[model samples]
Target: MSKDYPALTRDIAQYTGELRKLVPETMHSFYALSRAAGANGRIDAKTKELIALAIGITQRCDGCIGFHIKALHGMGASREEVAEVAAMSIYMGGGPALMYAADALRAFDQFDVPAV
Candidate 1:
């Protein structure tokens, strides 16, 4: 079954806000590392987000799936692009990955993105 992605996104935001308050320095460090990882290098930010989305499916991390899908949506990734990444995840991870790929696609479809 797929998750309610809008709810997931909202919950993540709330949880992150609370976590930041609890450990602001660690949270800032984590955010800095995340930014560094996503910075333009051999791969662009959009590609990195797509890779993160695929890995989230492979790893079956619902929170990771929500985060990366939101990032991909914000980056203007098409549904077809998400599908391609999902296909690769399925190929790499087999049946279980297929299940989470469905979840990822559901998030991609339902996640609320702000208009640019």
Candidate 2:
């Protein structure tokens, strides 16, 4: 069955907020690190999000895919761009990655932000 990307994102955010409250210092540090890692550097944020999406696919992490797809959609990534990234993820990770890559593409297409 297809997942609901927007609802998944909202749930993640709500759960994460509660987790943050439960472990304020730890969650704060993790959030700080996440922001730092996602900051634009040699690679632009768009490319970085693509890379993250690929990693998410390769790792088979649904939450990771949702987050990265949302970020990619927000950054105005094209469907073609997402497809190319998914291709690379499949190349690197083989069969298991294929499943998550499909999921990632679906998430990208269903995200609230439009693809370019």
Candidate 3:
């Protein structure tokens, strides 16, 4: 079955907000770590997002795949670029990664559509 990535991310965000309220200090630290990791240095933001996407695929985390793909889409990542990252993830992670990689590509396509 196909997933509604946009809706999935939205639901995740809603729950994440609740989690943040319960553990504001931890959530705040996590946010800071995320920001610092994603910050541009030698690597650009787009490339960092691609790396995150690949990691998400390998880890088989649907929420990570959805969020990272959405970020890549917002950064103007091409389908080809996402596919290349998926390929790399599959190579490193074998069959399980292959499944999540496909989901990641699906997430990319989902984000590609213009909202009506």
Candidate 4:
């Protein structure tokens, strides 16, 4: 069997809602601290998101990568941008990076941001 993403699936809405409940509070904690460190004044939001994506990949958190990539696009990151940033994770993480990057890439479609 072959697997691909950006396709229709079952049970996604439940998972999506569940993710919403957990992710917002966790993301806000980081966001609050980032702002407290004057990160709000220094780093742009998109860049921060890319940084988060990289970190998620490094940590091998499939959920983090998936959610952050979705968040990145929601913040206006493009597919090429996501692809570009995730590529660097390749050097930092090796094969695991490539694999997880694709998982993150799926967020682009799964989140209804439309493919770019």
**Backbone clash count for every predicted candidate, in the order shown:** 0, 0, 0, 0
Question: 1-116, model 3: which lDDT tens digit per residue?
Answer: 88899899999999999999999999999999999999999999889999999999999999999999999988989999999999999999999999999999899888888988
For candidate 2, what is the TM-score? 0.92
Best by lDDT: 3
The C-alpha lDDT values of all candidates are: 0.90, 0.88, 0.95, 0.69
Q: Candidate 2 — which pairs collide?
A: none
Model 1 pairs whose backbones collide: none
Task: Report the Cα lDDT for residue 78, model 3.
Answer: 94
Q: How far is each candidate from the true structure, as Cα RMSD in Å?
A: 2.3, 2.6, 0.8, 5.4
Worst 10 residues of 4 by lDDT: 1-10
Q: What is the lDDT of candidate 2?
A: 0.88
* The candidate that achieves the highest TM-score relative to the unseen native structure: 3
Poorly placed runs, candidate 2 (over 4 Å): 112-116
Error of 3 at 47 (Å): 0.8
| Minimal lDDT window, size 10, model 1 | 107-116
Once fitted onto the true fold, the runs of candidate 4 whose alpha carbons sit more than 4 angstroms away are 1-31, 34-39, 113-116
